[model samples]
Target: MQYKTVELVIEGKTATLFLNRAESMNAMNIKMIDEITKALKEVAASSVNLLFITGKGRVFSSGGDLKTMLSSTDESMFHPVMDQIKNMIVTLYTMKAVTVSFINGAAAGLGLSLALACDYVKLEKSAKVAMNFINIGLVPDGGGHFFLKKRLGEHKAKQIIWEGKSIPANDALQLGIVDEIYEGDIEEQLTFMKTKMEARPIQAMIASKMIYSTQELQHLVETLNLETMNQLEMRNTEDHREGVAAFLEKRIPHFSGK
Candidate 1:
């Protein structure tokens, strides 16, 4: 498929997928999610042994499209987008290509989840990341729960998710969230890592990834479905409305238990 929101490049045994909506901070709109899903599928089915995922602009991704959120009135508006996100995340999680994510700047909410889905996650030294769904009275989707628990265990993962605070790159690395924290250009680091992986037994690496990913696939699917259901319910709450209002108006949300 022709992609507008994502750019997919295929080179010898390596593929790079860029989140292309820089003006919007590469927000995960339906088009971006669909494009990513299709691109990942193509990479998985081809000769690509390594995949690099990164954003095109200063920030990795701001999160879901807030403009879309403002116009959404019901589950119909939410379901397809959520499902597309789920598909994209699942594809990235299970793909045969050894995937790497370069977080050049901020990665929040679903963006963080996308980074965490990759086999290796690298962050620029000053970059920050957050599972910030709580800020908007929502929960993390896109297999956020699944990946976090795997990396951080249930207790730490729950604390991170519930706090919804932006974590600095060093803090995130110490917390075991990101694999590496780099000082130089993340693009340069990504290129170096890709070359390193290409020299190794890529198929052997792919086999190991397949085994672990297969074992965890069912849990990830359940998490995605649960996130979808809960997000739809959250959309119906008064607090969600308040949160969106506060965000748009640049004020703190006054969330009352209604």
Candidate 2:
């Protein structure tokens, strides 16, 4: 199916979904969320057992469309946006295919969350990442908190989230956030991954992914709802307003606890 914000390319048994909005650094918006969920559902029902998700151009995703959200005057629109994001994350996390994230560039905020939801993540050496929700006076959404703590343990995860630091690809590789960091040609890297997945038992891999997700991600739905509420409250705060203003103005944000 055709999509405005995303592109789905199928080659034989392998499928690649490219985040297509390069102009905005592939920032995810409501329409993109809807398209992604629809595409994931389609792939889940298809014979394609391997799925690759990556971004177009310079960034993997700059996260939620902060510019759009901050500019909107309607509070009513926020809830549905978070809901769409939640549904998209849930769909990706629980999909039957063996999902992999190819992080070609920066992954921050909700972008990090989405990448972490995949079964495997590969990155280029120059790729960048951050869980920077706190920078905007927002809590991590899209299961970011859960995925981080699950991988890095509670103490380290809390430090990264609280500090809102951008991590280099080598650091991320050492931290185990990504499966591998490649310095070679992108096409070669993708070809290698495709071959690797093809060699594995597809059904067994899918079954293992499902079982692990069922046990580890049991609280995802509940957490997503809670994140929605928290983010809504944060959005109405003076600090969030300041953060957005500061971001757009390219200045330091002075957030008060209001």
Candidate 3:
């Protein structure tokens, strides 16, 4: 199928799903979310054993399209996009491949959440990441809470979410959010990791992934549902309005504890 927001390329036992909307810094809109879910399903049905997810341009994803959300006149348009985000994450997490998110640049908000869902993550040494929903007075959705707790546990996860800080590659590595950070020649890095995984008992690796993911599946579903519900409530708040306004106006947001 022809995909506008994402590109799926399969070669031998390897496949790549690239976030293709460089115009918006690969910001995930509803169309992009829809296409990502479809593209992931295509990969799941394929012969690929090693899967890579990255962005077309510099940024992995600037996160969710706040502009799109801001322009939304009806709340009806909002719910489906959140639903799509949930579906996309679930599909990626449980897919039958050893997945890696090669973040070549900035990954924030929903973008960071996507990376966190993957089995392994490789971030560019110069890249930065943040779970920055708080900047907009919003909660982290797209399974952010679940993934973070799996990695950082609840206390540290809560710290990152509340702080809304942009962490550098080394800092993220120390925080254990990403597996490795490579400097220059991402192609070389990709080739190396692809070869390394393929050399392993690939099916066994996939089996273990499926086993763990299946065990935690119910909790992930609950998190997604809760995120969707809370995020909807956040959108109606005065603080969220101020945050978006402050972001667009290039100023500090005065978030009332509303």
Best by lDDT: 3
lDDT of 3 by residue, 75-103 (tens): 79888888899999999999999999999
Residue pairs clashing in model 2 are none
Give candidate 2's error at residue 235 in angstroms: 0.9
Looking at model 3, residue 104 earns an lDDT score of: 84
Q: How many backbone clashes can be found in candidate 3?
A: 0
**Taking the tens digit of each residue's C-alpha lDDT, what string does model 1 give over 49-112?**
8999999988889888888777766767788888888888889999988999999889999889
Clashing pairs for predicted structure model 1, backbone only: none
Model 2, C-alpha of 108: deviation from truth (Å): 0.8
Q: Say what the RMSD of model 2 is.
A: 1.3
State the weakest 10-residue window (summed lDDT) of model 3: 66-75
Better of 2 and 3 by lDDT: 3
Q: After the best TM-score superposition of candidate 3, give how far the Cα of residue 132 lies from its true spot, in angstroms.
A: 0.5
Clashes of 2: 0
Query: Would you list the C-alpha lDDT of every candidate in the order shown?
Result: 0.89, 0.86, 0.91
lDDT of 2 by residue, 8-69 (tens): 98888788898989999999877888898888888877888888999988888999887677
Model 2 bad stretches (over 4 Å): none
Instruction: Tell me, by TM-score, which candidate is best.
Output: 3
TM-score, model 3 to reference: 0.98
- The CA lDDT at 146 in model 2 is 80
